[model samples]
Target: MTRPWTVRLAAGLVAATAVLTGCSEKQEANETLPTNGAAETTPELPPLGPEDFPVPAEAREMTPEGAVAFVRYYVGLTKFVAENSLDPEPLLQLSQDCRTCIRIAQSLDEDRAANRRYTEYAYEFTGYGPAMLDGETAQMGFLYVQGPITVVDQAGKVVTDRSAPTPVELQSGAVLLWKPEQATWVITGLTVG
Candidate 1:
């Protein structure tokens, strides 16, 4: 059977940009209206397992522990974005050349432009391995999250629903390449499924 939560597949490290067609025309700056401060305050989302995520000290870190913390934080951030009607501008900044991250940001932009939202969103990481360092580039292995994901419209109607099951093996974790000049790790790679 087809897995659920395809629309909510928030893991991957494709390329920098996605060229998807068939989407509605882009909305002009003035044409888009803004909502009141309702979305500003965090909505009452389902509580994610508190112990599952490790907070990061900074956006960029130089150590292996920092890298793992960063990945965990990134995963949590993506899940939050998926479950709430929020802006994706910040996520774009975290990516350097990660295609998956770009695609997710683009998809969020599209959803916002169309006044769409996702709900009943949940995910769980099955594996989070240590970082495999190769020179300045580090490859974090066996990291994956899977769960049910649902989308809804402004009217509170379901649009798409999918359930992601734990995979036989962890697909791939985030590929973080260290930039000495920047003094931080940039997420350059990720793979889901």
Candidate 2:
């Protein structure tokens, strides 16, 4: 039989990928600003709701609630990676030995190699479901979210815009394991399907 930690790792990776892969949502709003002689227009970020994931202030506190919060925070990070193909240093510190995390990092490399960039990237969580709690680790099962992603070339022209009318429902079956000594939650695995 596989070790319990091994099982947890698998679950974590699966869930993480599900969330990470679906990280392409854009909120388009044009705002007008007064310039020297005329009005200038700029795009505004998407509106945020409670369901949206916010980066946590303290990740090391151990609790079921903390695990859930961490997972929520992770969703935001996933969206950042998908849109920009860039890995945030703060998130990298939390995720150690996480395959999805590595894949995200690699995607940035691929984009650079191909001379492409992504923009108007965003994600939204429809639901933050209850987590399956063990002792130190927790599995956040099947949280649904949706968004769009747009790719651009080095010349600043639009390449591919993977946008859809319906929000892509990601049954984010992500698993997170907490570390008391480190005061953080490590993503052991993510099930993308």
Top TM-score hit: 1
What candidate 1 gets wrong by more than 4 Å, as runs, is 1-55, 126-128, 161-170, 180-183
Candidate 2 residue spans exceeding 4 A from truth: 1-55, 81-91, 112-115, 161-166
lDDT per residue, candidate 1, 1-193, as tens digits? 6465653463322221242332345855687578885667633323222334323445356676667766667777777766665676556655578998888778877777778776655665644555777787777755464545666777977665322332233466788877666455667877766
Worst 10 residues of 1 by lDDT: 10-19
User: Per-residue CA lDDT of candidate 2, range 1-193, in tens?
Assistant: 7899999999999999988877755656669755698657754333221223434544335766667667666766766655655534445656767787677657666675667776666566533555677887777765555645666777987665433334576666667887656566777766544
Give the clashing pairs for model 1: 4-162, 4-163, 5-162, 5-163, 13-190, 14-99, 14-100, 15-99
What TM-score does candidate 1 get on C-alpha atoms? 0.60
Worst 10 residues of 2 by lDDT: 44-53
Predictions in order: lDDT: 0.62, 0.62
TM-score of every model?
0.60, 0.58
TM-score of 2: 0.58
